[model samples]
Target: MARAGSVAPRQRASAAPESGQRPGRRLLPRSRILLVLALVAALGAAGFGAWALYGSQWLRIEKVSVAWESGSRRELTADQVLSEAAVPLGAPMASLDKDAIEDRLLAALPRLKSVRVVRAWPHGVGLKVTEREPSAQVPAPGGFAEVDEEGVRFAEIAEPLPSVPLLEPDMADAPSVRRFDEERTLREAVAVAAALPEPLAERTSVIRIASYDAITLELSDDRTVRWGSPEDSSAKAGALTILMKAAPDARHFDVSVPSAPAASGG
Candidate 1:
């Protein structure tokens, strides 16, 4: 023990920290918290989407609409298209077989060149259609069958179209018909008619197919063009234009060999 006068150096207070000092406030990692939040958001979005796509009546097809594409002329009315499409009412918009609907419309209507089936959001199914335009007229059993530029016979008319030319394939003992078939010959004639220059095409009254290589064009004025085969049609057209300009009075033109054209019978 030390002497009385001086207190033995007051016991130094322990400076050591207390044991188990709350380990850095155990906290959730920032990344873990963000991941949990993302999962919750994703679950919520998926639930909402499912409800909208299937469970909700609001997203069902309540109305159907039909429209022409590109202001195409209507051979069949909207009612006719709707009847043929027969899209199931009350079906979920997301559950619709759009391709099937399009196929149905095309199969049922020959006048349609193409069709687009659209989901008009919220509660509608829409149909957009393009109608085939007559490229030529063919004499059929009942009436003249209207053929498009692709040579598809789509519809029939009682009266002939004045603006369009008549396609006359020589089905009577033609050698080309025996070899290439009548359908092929008709297509070839259609190609020649389609390739005719603008005013000339408009003025053409008949496209006569005698043989595969013996296609001819008769203008409204009774002038004739020996167009020969569908091959080199562009060259033939060019030659015909030049020949017409050179000898406007000629009644018959032969442009089978575009390099050497001929005109006669003025």
Candidate 2:
């Protein structure tokens, strides 16, 4: 029976879920379906574009051109690099292996320091090469070998370069030779030669390397320059320039310590 002051408890609200979604579940929005369709269409278009780039004849490679860096002075020819490259012709530009071509050319030509293979739009591939510069001429069995800045004996030349100094190294005594590597004394000699100024370099005949610390330069006039080691070469060179002018009649110059240079034996 109902109480006098209070009506029966209000009937509990319906326990069932709303018409839109069940409890703890969600409905997929119509906007989301459209977004998903658009994303899939964009992905399909990208895939088709990639396929066309990979297989189309209109984008194929028709010509391969080789270029040398200006004033390289290397014996290599563009034809030689191109022949060694064996570029994949008639293939799509986007699918060609440029690195492989560059590696091939470098392997075939020791004088080549670096190489680049570029895709010229439409139908051409361009190859550019930078060759190593000879820093010194080291004596070999029958001829001289050109050494680069990194002490690499890159090429053999019949005659030594007049501008570059010749190196006379006794690698048999170097500890590195026993270790199955190039002698450090030889590199020290090359460093000494590569640092000489133009006047000294042109008149320089041969560099004698007794060891890393005993490097001597024999000039064309038979004058000697005692260069102790490869360190402080720039400072030593500058000091030598001043010492030569200060003592024009001196025949021997020692600038191992630029701070205390000496000249004697006129």
lDDT of the candidates, in the order given:
0.88, 0.83
TM-score of each: 0.80, 0.79
169-198 in candidate 1: lDDT tens per residue? 876787767688889888777777777777
lDDT of 2 at 212: 62
Q: Write the per-residue lDDT of candidate 2 for residues 1-266, one digit (tens) a residue.
A: 88899878789897787789866745469778988999999999999888778866788899999887787766788788888999988998898898898888888888999999999988999998899987789888869999987888889988888878898875557554554334766776777777888788888898877656667888898889998777888898889889989998899999878899999997
In candidate 2, list every pair of residues with a backbone clash. Answer: none
The weakest ten consecutive residues by lDDT in model 1 span 19-28
State which candidate has the highest TM-score.
1
